[model samples]
Target: MSFVPIICGKRDWDVEYAQSQEYNAIYCPNCHNYKVRPVKRREFITIWFIPVMPFFWGKQLVCPICNWRQDFKSDEQLKKVLREQDNIRAGKVGG
Candidate 1:
């Protein structure tokens, strides 16, 4: 007789707002790729490739090009990021 143990867990992210042109054009600090996107962070505990529990849901700005993530501590922080993107689109600042 033999027994095997398997452990699995993963973090998931969903695109909450991806309509900002400036956000898409922004360059990633890690990869220097112009593919930064807005995403909401979600973590889950999985058993046998199935999500069993979800936790730590929050807003974030991510660079899909290099898998970089900037988590938001509060709603104000998320709003600030959005405002920054808008400012970039408006040419008020460099993206």
Candidate 2:
């Protein structure tokens, strides 16, 4: 009889991301590119590389070049960030 050992453990962050069109014109401060993309993030638990349960989820603005993530709990919050950033870009506020 031969037995093969299988590694089994829970892994975090099974994220699902989708870019939003609302902030497509926004530029990333770190990379100096107009690539500030809004993404939906979902964290899940995995067993043997299979997602079995979801633990956390949220929306964020991600800079692809810098890999910076800014989290928001609601649509209103995201809109607030967009407005704030736009103001900064317009020289109406100090970033």
Candidate 3:
């Protein structure tokens, strides 16, 4: 009988922001559009097309239109941007 090798490898899993209101305040320089939003990226070990374990995790602001990504140093830094966006939407000047 011929042996069938199992397919195993690393894979990227992305979780987009789930808020009811889409965050579109961040501008994308690459696409020149307001489609930048936060996303959670996880690198996982996959076996037989199934994710086994996550080895790496990160948060980034990404533009879906142009595939632009900006990594955040910390959760606080990311939160600061979200708060600024909220302020901007509220018409608060000089956030």
Candidate 4:
């Protein structure tokens, strides 16, 4: 039998936040639109293009249209945006 070399590398996966709005009121400086949403970026070790182990992770408010991103320093900061989004959805705040 011939031995095959294993390919291991890091990969990033962008995951949408569960409570995020479909189209938030936050404006994207790059896209000039209100198409921002909370997103989680997960970095993983991949073998043959399949994720195996997690390496690193981060959170951001991103625009899917133009790929504009704003990184979050802490969960509280991220939650603040999410709360604003909820207020907008509930008509408590102007969108």
Best by lDDT: 3
Between which residue pairs do clashes occur in model 2?
none
**For residues 8-69, could you state the per-residue lDDT of candidate 3 as single tens digits?**
99998789855446455576768887778888889999999899999988888898888999
Predicted structure 1: clash tally:
0
- Which sequence of candidate numbers ranks them by lDDT, best first? 3, 4, 1, 2
Candidate 4 structure lDDT: 0.77
Model 3 TM-score on a 0 to 1 scale: 0.65
Error (Å) of candidate 3 at residue 50 is: 1.6
RMSD of 1: 4.0
What is the number of backbone collisions in each predicted candidate, taken in the order shown? 0, 0, 0, 0
Model 3: residues >4 Å from true position, as ranges? 18-22, 79-95
**Residue 13 of candidate 4: its Cα lDDT?**
84
Highest TM-score model number: 2
Model 3, residue pairs in steric clash: none
Q: Residues 27-75, candidate 2: write the lDDT tens digits.
A: 6777888877777777767766787787767777788788876777887
Worst 10 residues of 1 by lDDT: 18-27
